[model samples]
Target: MAEFVEVAKTSEIPAGGAKVVEVNGKKIAIFHVDGEFYAIDDTCSHEDASLAAGTVDGTEVMCPLHGARFDLKTGKNLSLPAVFPVQSYALKIENGVIYIQV
Candidate 1:
């Protein structure tokens, strides 16, 4: 089983926003959408853009570099230019802390 590590506090990510956190030297993007939290790899599959710096719209995040869109909830590439989907990590919430299983 993968280990769950506390990545950030719930308050750290504002609603309808995303945050980039380093876990075990790996960059992970955490998003807060519609009162739910989703975790995914920070790097854009199409380029070197950081998804955490991208715009968060509902459950989808747009790549800031080439405008590739990804579904934060399922790690699905929803637009062109990104043929591969970014990796997504399991997430759990405990008391107000967000934990990610990597």
Candidate 2:
């Protein structure tokens, strides 16, 4: 089983927002949507843009570099320029702290 690493607290990211965190030296994006938390690879599949800096609309985030949209729940590439989906990670919350397994 993959070990879950505590990355940040729930208050660190607002609802419908995301934060960038390093897990094992890999950049990961932690998102807070509605009342749920999700995680995914921070790098865009088509370009080197940081998804954590992208804009979030519901469960989808738009790549700031090329406007490529990706589904946070599944890391599916939902627009052009990105032919492959980014990686998605497992997440959990305990005592208001967010943990990720990449």
Candidate 3:
């Protein structure tokens, strides 16, 4: 089973925003959407764009480089220019702390 690692505090991510955290040498993107948290790989499938620097709207995250849209909740690629789906990690919030299963 994957172990949960404390990535960041709940207050670190603003509303409709995302933050990148390195856990076990892996880059993970933590997103805050509508008061909920979602974790996914920071690297974009297409090119080398950072999803953490992209725009966050609800559960969707758009790539800042080529406007590739991805669903943060399911790691699904919604638009073109990005054929491969980004990896997604499990997220848990406890006592105002954000934990990710890595």
Candidate 4:
């Protein structure tokens, strides 16, 4: 069974901010938006770019490289140049800490 790994604290990521963490040796991007948290693969599916550095709009992120957009909730590619979807992780919060299932 997959286990949930502690990634970050709620305070570590402010609203409309993002952080990159390695869980089970894979880089995952954690986002805090509108008082909620979301997690997805840190790498962009379109290019060799970091999604953590992308722009967050609502619940989606626009890739900084080629402008590929991805839905933070489902990791679905929302724009062009990205033919595949990045992996989305299950995230849960307890107290003030964030956990990502891996």
On TM-score, the leading prediction is 4
Writing each residue's lDDT as its tens digit, candidate 4 over 1-102 gives 999989999999989999999977889999999998999999999878999999999999999999999999999998899999999999899999999899
Q: What is the per-residue lDDT of model 1 for residues 1-102, given as tens digits with 9 covering 90 to 100?
A: 689999999999999888999998989999998899999999999989899999888789999988999999778899989999998998999999999998
For every candidate structure, what is the RMSD over all alpha carbons to the true structure, in angstroms? Answer: 0.9, 0.9, 0.9, 0.6
Candidate models: Cα lDDT each: 0.92, 0.93, 0.90, 0.94
| Per-prediction tally of clashes | 0, 0, 0, 0
Candidate scoring better on lDDT of 1 and 3: 1
Best by lDDT: 4
Off by over 4 Å in 1: none
Q: What clash pairs does model 3 have?
A: none
lDDT of 3 by residue, 1-102 (tens): 789988899999998888999987878899988888999889999999899999877789999999999999888999989999988988888999999988
